[model samples]
Target: MTVLLIALGAALGAPLRYLTDRAVQARHGSPFPWGTLTVNVAGSLLLGGLLAAPVDPAVTALVGTGFCGALTTWSTLSYETLRLARTGKRRLAYANAALSVAAGLGAAFLGYALVTALTG
Candidate 1:
C-alpha cells in the first residue's frame, strides 16, 4: 500500500519536475540552471511543509519521500555545476552550488515555520 502510494506520487512528480524545469529554464536565458534550483527549493519547501503537518505516514511516504525525492535532482545539480565549470562559467557553477544549498535550506525552514505557525 505504501509502496503503491509512493510509486503513484513519483509517477506524478517526475513528469511535473521535468515540465517545471523546462518551463522555468525557457523563461531564463542564463545557463545558471535556474530550473534545477527552482525544483530543489520547491521540493524542499513542500517536503518541509508536509512533514510539519499533522498527516499520516502514508501521506508522508507518498509526497515527502516519493514526490519530493523525484522532484529534486541532486545528480542534475552536480552535473550542471560541473558543466558550467567546464564551460568556463566557474563563477556561475560556484554560485549555483552555494545558492542551491542556501535557498533550499531557507525554503525548508520557511515552510516548516509557516506550517507550524498555522497549525498551532
Candidate 2:
C-alpha cells in the first residue's frame, strides 16, 4: 500500500514538475534554469513542512520520498549548470549553483519553522 501510494504520488508530482518548469522557464526567458530552481525550492519547502509536522509514515513516504523526490531534479540542475559553464556562461552557472542551494535551504527552513509554530 505504501509503495502504491508512493508511485501514485510520483506519477502526479513528475507531471506537475514538468508543467511548472515549462511555465516558469517560458516566463523568465533567461538562460539560467529558473524552472529547476523553482521546483527544487518548492519541493524542499514541502518536504520540510511534512517532516516537521506529525504526519503518518505513509504520508511521509508518499509526499516526501515520492512527490518531493520526483519534483526535485538534482541531475537536471547538474546538467544545466555544466551546460552553462561549457557554453561560456560560467557566471550564470556559478550563480545558479549557489543560488539554488541557498534558496532551497532557506525555503526548507522557513517551511519547517512555519509548521512548527503552527502546530505548537
Candidate 3:
C-alpha cells in the first residue's frame, strides 16, 4: 500500500514538474531554467506544509517522499547552473544558486508557519 501510494504520487509529481518546467520555459525561455527554480520553491513550500500537518505516515510517504521529491529537481538545477557557467553567464549562475537556496528556504519556512498557524 505504501509503495502504491508513493508510485501514484510520483506519477502525478513528475508530470506536474514537467508542465511547470514547460510553462516557465515558455514564458522565460531556456536561458536560466527559471522553471526548475520555481518548482523547487513551490515543492519546498508544499513539503513544509505537509511536514507541519498532522498527516499519517502513508500520506507523508506519498506527498513528501514521492510527490515533492519528484517535483523538486536539484539535479536539473545543478545542470542548468553549470550550463550557465559554461556559457559564460557566471553572474547569472551564481545568482540562480543563491536565489534558489535562499528563496526555497524562505518559502518552506513560510509554509510551515502558515500550516502551524492554521492547525493551531
Model 2 misses residue 38 by how many Å? 0.5
Misplaced by over 4 Å in model 3 are: none
- Residues 19-103 of candidate 2 have per-residue lDDT tens digits of 9999999998689999999999999999889979999999998999889989999999999999999999999999999999999
- Candidate 2 residue pairs that clash: none
Please give, for residues 1-120, the per-residue lDDT of candidate 3 as tens digits: 998889989999999999999998889755887899989999999988987999999999899988998999999999999999999999999999999999999989988999999997
lDDT of model 3, residue 56:
98
Question: What lDDT would candidate 1 get against the real structure?
Answer: 0.94
> Could you tell which candidate, 2 or 3, scores higher by lDDT?
2
Clash pairs, candidate 1, are none
My TM-score estimates for the predictions, one after another, are 0.97, 0.97, 0.96
**Model 1 deviation from the true structure expressed as Cα RMSD, one decimal place:** 0.7
Q: All predictions: root-mean-square deviation over Cα?
A: 0.7, 0.7, 1.0
Model 1 misplaced regions, further than 4 Å: none
Model 2 off-target regions past 4 Å?
Answer: none
